[model samples]
Target chain A: MSGWVKIAGLGPGNEALVTPEVTAALAEATDVVGYIPYVARVAERPGLTLHASDNRVEIDRSQHALRMAAEGKRVVVVSSGDPGVFAMAAAVFEALENGPDTWREIPVEVLPGITAMLAAAARAGAPLGHDFCAINLSDNLKPWAVIEKRLRLVAQADFAMAFYNPRSKSRPEGFVKTLEILRQECEPERLILFARAVSRPDEAIRIATLAEATPDMADMQTVVIVGSSLTRVIDRPIGPIVYTPRSTPE
Target chain B: MSGWVKIAGLGPGNEALVTPEVTAALAEATDVVGYIPYVARVAERPGLTLHASDNRVEIDRSQHALRMAAEGKRVVVVSSGDPGVFAMAAAVFEALENGPDTWREIPVEVLPGITAMLAAAARAGAPLGHDFCAINLSDNLKPWAVIEKRLRLVAQADFAMAFYNPRSKSRPEGFVKTLEILRQECEPERLILFARAVSRPDEAIRIATLAEATPDMADMQTVVIVGSSLTRVIDRPIGPIVYTPRSTPE
Candidate 1:
């Protein structure tokens, strides 16, 4: 059996989005590792052994999988979105890079999948037209200091930004401060797009503004998109959407 | 017979990357509207009507499709990437907005397709890890003044940027001037990525510097990504993919 680890993109929790190429790779693996919800997307296959855990403990789980792969297991790691976009592909690589050199020989293949940002953009029409950035608010593995630096960077660029891991109860001040910092660099009337439970039926997406979005309007599943300078509010009956471009090059 | 437009994304021109959902959407539509090459991706669909044109006349084809839809014809508008991301969706809406208001109620649906930026990033292995921006070199719709203003914003933001439509026979000077503007706010060593034909059969994605990427290295099909303060170049077998994020935060 191939001992290398394969990182598969499950694609926004919908099995329909999983490509045959990716499914064939997963079917050949002996073990799969992922967050509990993501692992469940595959249902069950006879040859696969699933290792699941809470979302907060991703690093530990990823490290465990890497160890197993190092020991000659055909491991398939799973992520809801494309593995590299804020997913386990990076975690697995980081753990390998920072640890022993013996695991360097372990081949890692990253399969692409759809991300929540694009899904929300698809639902709303064209919020991601201009230059955009995605930042996570969960300050777990990274320091708040670094996150603040990135947020400021995002605002200064005036990029349409989608914020993931925005709030979890313990991180109550997540939105208030980030929005304040963003408002300093961007306009107050700028649109802020929120998408919760995207693609899983009962999916809701809304476009509001910094002055309009309240803390009561957000939760863990929500993705907050702060519009760039050109973001506009349309009068379509299905509510409003924010539109930005890749860039406004001179 | 119902005439609806289903805008599909043909990822970087590779048939394998086009999702099944998009394929099904194409199957349901009678007429397909897009640039000549993009329509060729799904040409073999049985009982399908194909309306293809040169790149210069894409907007005209989109308008024609909307007209067909307005006449109760089920049409599908095809864009190589996501329809909303600088593709055909806006042109269709622009036509609807400029014409009769009755067309607004035509039950228009924008599906999420894989963007070239993400497709390029995936092929490059995590280049867009942190804050990034995308800009188009084409200035047909946007004025040069706006492009310069946005370029300054990109520099001050220190954003990792991907440049779309960087060069054409008409606008060879645009990329050069943009580089000069970017150098004003960033270091000379910043990695500038050029991804041409990503995920396509003849795909080519290269990482260079703003100074290094000349007009010789780019054309209409190129997608250039410029590095941020955090982006680091990793040497791999293919080439260097500039990565920004070190690890996923808690």
Candidate 2:
């Protein structure tokens, strides 16, 4: 049989959010590769094999998946959210670029899924309705200085901001510093949303202001959205809705 | 029956891209409302009514949806991509904020979808794998000055950029000015991907550099992606893959 590799996204921990294209890819795959949690998300079958690796080894994992596909195996690399957003699609391309030219001939496709930022934003009533920037706050691959610089610039641009991998057990102080920067740059009433395990059974959402936001509010599982100056809040008997209007004054 | 409204995203253009959540909403909707084309995507059923409106009347469409839902109808407002991203979710919330307080009691939800940027980025490789910003270039709502200021700051920050509504028949000059600003701010060889009618049968993707790109390359159907300095291109026999790397030097 011919070999092919599909980088697919299982969107934001919700089965309903998985697109039909991604579902078909997983069904036809003989081998699945990804981080431990993501690989565990795929079911085990008679002909299918799952390779679950630890985090921070994306390069190694990409090479392994490429090798399997080059050996005429149908491989699917599963990412938690859209693979193009700080996920496996770029890693696969990076591997293909640095690997043998023969591997480049293999059929490769990146199937999009509902990314975490959009999923989180939808649950919070469209805090990202206006222009926005998505920044991955992990300093593992880059420097914290770069993260700090982008935060300041995004605030200055008045773009709604979505942050991924905000805080982890190893690096808890990063989010604290992030909150401090936002507090200094934005107004005290700037809207902030902390969405945890969105669309999952344990999903929870919290809306707060810059002054009320604390570092402990966000963890690795959380996706934080900071609204622009024009974002509004509506209090209702059911619940409060927060949304950023599409139009802005000149 | 109690009244409710759901603002759902139909994905870029494919039925496969539509989420099961959105499909369920449409299946149970007593009335569906949206732009002419989007409403046409919904299948006809005995108890369902489709309200197709012209462009530039989002507020009117939103208020109509709200009114129907408040009258004890299950209403669904459809948008081409994710409703939270430059779409109807904000419009519905705006209507809710300004309309009668009684309307606020109506149950409302925003269902996310695979946005055009992510869909386009997947079709190309993963040009949005790193830090990225999404900007709507339509001057009909916001000022051209704001769009230019964002382009400059985004280039300065070295974030990959996605431009929606890049060009239309009426506002062709906006894209021309946009290209000029990018040419001045970004390098001549900065990578740009013009993805037209993405995820549709007529989908077309073109990879070009800032110097090689022309304003006519993108129309309203196109979603433009401008890569950061770190973006790379891999040429293969089938096609070229464009992706932004995950890391940058200090």
Candidate 3:
């Protein structure tokens, strides 16, 4: 085993797309720790020690994995997208910081992997053409007031934004406020892209105008791309495509 | 052959991670046209007709592919990253849009794949944690006057920036003006990330200050990430890690 344990992002979805290096790590890890579905990504690995838990247990789960690593065990902390993009890497560090003195010496190596924002941008025909931001409307960690203020400020800046956690069953009303602010400062026809289950089997990607997109089309499983003023959406007979050019000079 | 043909993005590097559906498309196509490097992404198949070309022949290459598709050939147009992100898909559309009347009947599909911005962000510890923009400094088609205005607006907007094609051998003196402008507007302590040939074997990823990341450290092959004012460079004894968090309400 490598001296330091490696926490790798397997990208957004589908295990088959996982790199050979990540696959090899999964095959050899003494334990693979992640949320239930994320841990299931490596379920087929022969003779694996799986530590699957609920989605809300970031701190506790990370602490458990760090303890194993501190004891010199070969553990692989798994994250869906890139390790640090709202993934488990930060939680690992947070846990390590709060761990016992003996565990502070543990070495950690983070291997980069593709993230969903780039994946979503890529999937939707370059909706990430210019400046963009990603915000989690989860409200689990931060209040809606903070997210709203940043959205209003960023929307005014003409950014091509990607919205993560735009809507959930409980958060159905959140995107309405977010979109209202975006429409207030942005043009009505600016493209808004929805990339659902990117790189997964039931993939669905579509580009629509901001006025046409609805929350019914998106769930927590979807990542929305609200194009900057430069972003454009074209509807073909086959499907709709979005493009945000680098910039259009005035 | 089917009436429609698929244009695909083969990703920045590594073939094992290619989506199964995309792989099948390449195998099934009777004809495929792409830049040399992109054409080589898929393994050679005897039944497949491979059309490869020189670097600077974008319009001619795309025109040739469309002409064949008009003649009822199942042609797949390929590019390294997503076909539309400063790549071939849009060029193909541009060519098709202006072509002969008979050519309009052919069907086209743009499939999604990974891009370098994503591959770089994934590797660099998700410095793309918030809003960002990507600009290609190559002035082959667009004018520098336009690039400068867009850069200034985005810089003043407080968006994270990813500079693509910052410099090449021909344009050795590029990115200096961009670096200078952004530095003047943002804090000097803001993080500047250099990720070169990301995901490829000889990858060099370094996190530097805005003042430190001069053009000497970059080339056409690099992806530059200019951090937001909120970005923090955590310098562990191992190395520096860039983290830009959602600004908690003051």
Candidate with maximal lDDT: 2
TM-score of 1: 0.89
By DockQ, the best candidate is: 2
When summed lDDT is taken over every stretch of 10 residues in candidate 3 chain B, the lowest stretch is B241-250
**Over the full model, what C-alpha lDDT does candidate 2 score relative to the true structure?**
0.93
lDDT of each: 0.72, 0.93, 0.70
Better of 1 and 3 by lDDT: 1
Candidate 1 segments exceeding 4 Å error: A141-158, A182-188, A236-250, B209-213, B233-242, B247-250
Model 2 interface Cα RMSD in Å: 0.8
DockQ, candidate 1, vs. native dimer: 0.37
Regarding TM-score, does 1 or 2 come out ahead?
2
Model 2, residue A225: displacement in angstroms?
0.2
True-vs-predicted CA distance for residue A30, candidate 2, Å: 0.8
RMSD of each: 3.2, 1.0, 3.7
* Candidate 2 segments exceeding 4 Å error: none
- Residue B151, candidate 3: Cα error in Å is 3.9
Tens digits of per-residue lDDT, candidate 1, A52-72, equal 888867668768887888787
lDDT of 2 by residue, B1-250 (tens): 3979999999999999999999999999999999999999999999999999998999999999999988999999999989999999999999999999899899999999989999999999999999999999998888888888888888888899999999999998999999999988889999999999999999999999999999999999999999999999999998889999998888
